[model samples]
Target: MVASTHRDRPIGVFDSGVGGLTVLHELLVQLPQEDFVYLADTARFPYGERSQAELQEFSLQIAEELIRRQVKLLVVACNSATAAALPLLQERMMRTTLGVDVIGVVRPGAVHAVAATRTGRVGLLATTATVESGAYAEAIAAADPHVDLVQVPCPDLTEIIEGGFPFDQRVVDTVRRYCAPLREARVDTVVLGCTHYPLVRPMLQRMLGPGVTIISSGAPLARQVEHVLGSRSLQAGRTEGEGTYSFLCTGDPEPFRTMGTRFLQMPLGEVAQVDVAGGALAGGGPALA
Candidate 1:
């Protein structure tokens, strides 16, 4: 019999905004027995424009906060953060006794895109920061050097998905405009480099056409999370009840909760407003275990 460990601790997930909720959605589906704690740095939304040093600092602060909360795993669900700060975050975590695994969205998406592409022509739709970071390009090359990657950096896609209500024509037009280059490239596979892209996946799929396979981070990352937990014997053993989840945002909680439910497609319970350092929690009631 295995002694009880950190198995019951919630898995921590964070993004620049509600975009990482897309990753949480996959984790909830793939590992429903485990609970989750999600943090959104909405006050600093659109982290795509932030500098590498800032991203590293922000990622470290968030990681320390999650570690304080006793999270068993940390998932960097933001592409910009993953591209810029994953190494620093992981290195910092290595100093801790728990040393939680840090998984990012870039390599998994790249590997999936590479495996999915048949024609050797792949397209990437991402924020300007992610494209500029060149992380995906390197990952795709490491996975398969022969595959050609056409990357398009969209300026307004994340903001549109975050703020645009009712999914208006502007959102469609923006998505269409981004997909135009991918369409012109006639790519066999497209990678949604940003976590927020999943929310508009249907629209992206339609824009990219039915034949082109689209890959996102959530599903692939979810599988990796599961594997990490299982290999380390950190998986929750509960078999009778559904795992609970809650929200912590650096900005207003109401908007985070409201906008987040749409992204996660699940009920978002209590949301507390938190500071960048992760202390000074305000508002929201306790989440059920």
Candidate 2:
């Protein structure tokens, strides 16, 4: 069993890659006093195509690493990872770790989507794995079965956003194509099913038109994190100083660092590189302090 005594430590957030930065951005805005550590499993690149077992194993490995770092809370910032591993992670953590909490994006986003839709028609734009897992569909259905859901599996949107081409015409065109069916179905609200999707919110808004509302998982997820931390009394005390941000990547650090700066709208000092060897975190490189 892992023991945790830290109560004022930073929150840990992880994704298959830089997509989770969308959640991280919101967290920073909502909880400026809290520090954050973000892990991007860039070596895996996209968890969207992986098997359930594979994704769960990877999520467990990263969660263990974050636990080792003494985070007071854990946020499965990626929709695919959340859908694949949240239950197992929560169970394991509750059985072993103490004074820490784990939260995921799907349920919070689903609740918000259900609340925001006026026509009871909702659209979900997410990775192929999330759509296949039926995570959002089930969550929203549970919240309100009357909601008519249109799930669109956006294949390469994460890659495009992580590639720093989120605003390019090609990206907009792809978003337009993906959203066409939802528009035809007259969905009044669209859920940004993947964390990375928020990086292209402008494009999504344009494609969705003014009448349609686009909701990302960020704000809701951040609110959940805040609630958990507050309930546990793990919320940080107010500090005038700028909170620190730490980043880790399982692939080449340079590209992730560059793209993170672009997507987060802030300069990421340095990104450390780590490797998963034999399904465990092994090598560790330097990270910005």
- Give lDDT: candidate 1, residue 268: 93
What lDDT tens digits, residue by residue, belong to model 2 across residues 1-289?
Answer: 2223354588999998888888899999998888899999999878887888888888877876776777778899999988887887786655443445689999999999899999999999999999999999999999999999999999888777776662777887888889899889999999998888877787788888899988888899999988887777776764576678899999999989888886677778989897643423211222211
Per-residue lDDT, model 1, residue 201, is 91
CA lDDT of every candidate: 0.87, 0.83
Residue pair clashes in candidate 2: none
Of candidate 2, the 10-residue stretch with the lowest lDDT total is 280-289
For residue 99, give model 1's deviation from the true position in Å: 1.2
* Model 1: per-residue Cα lDDT over 42-93, one tens digit each: 9888987788877877787777778778888899999999999888678667
Q: CA lDDT of 72 in candidate 2?
A: 76
TM-score of each model, in listed order:
0.93, 0.91
Rate residue 66 of model 2 by lDDT.
77
Which regions of candidate 1 deviate over 4 angstroms? 1-3, 278-289
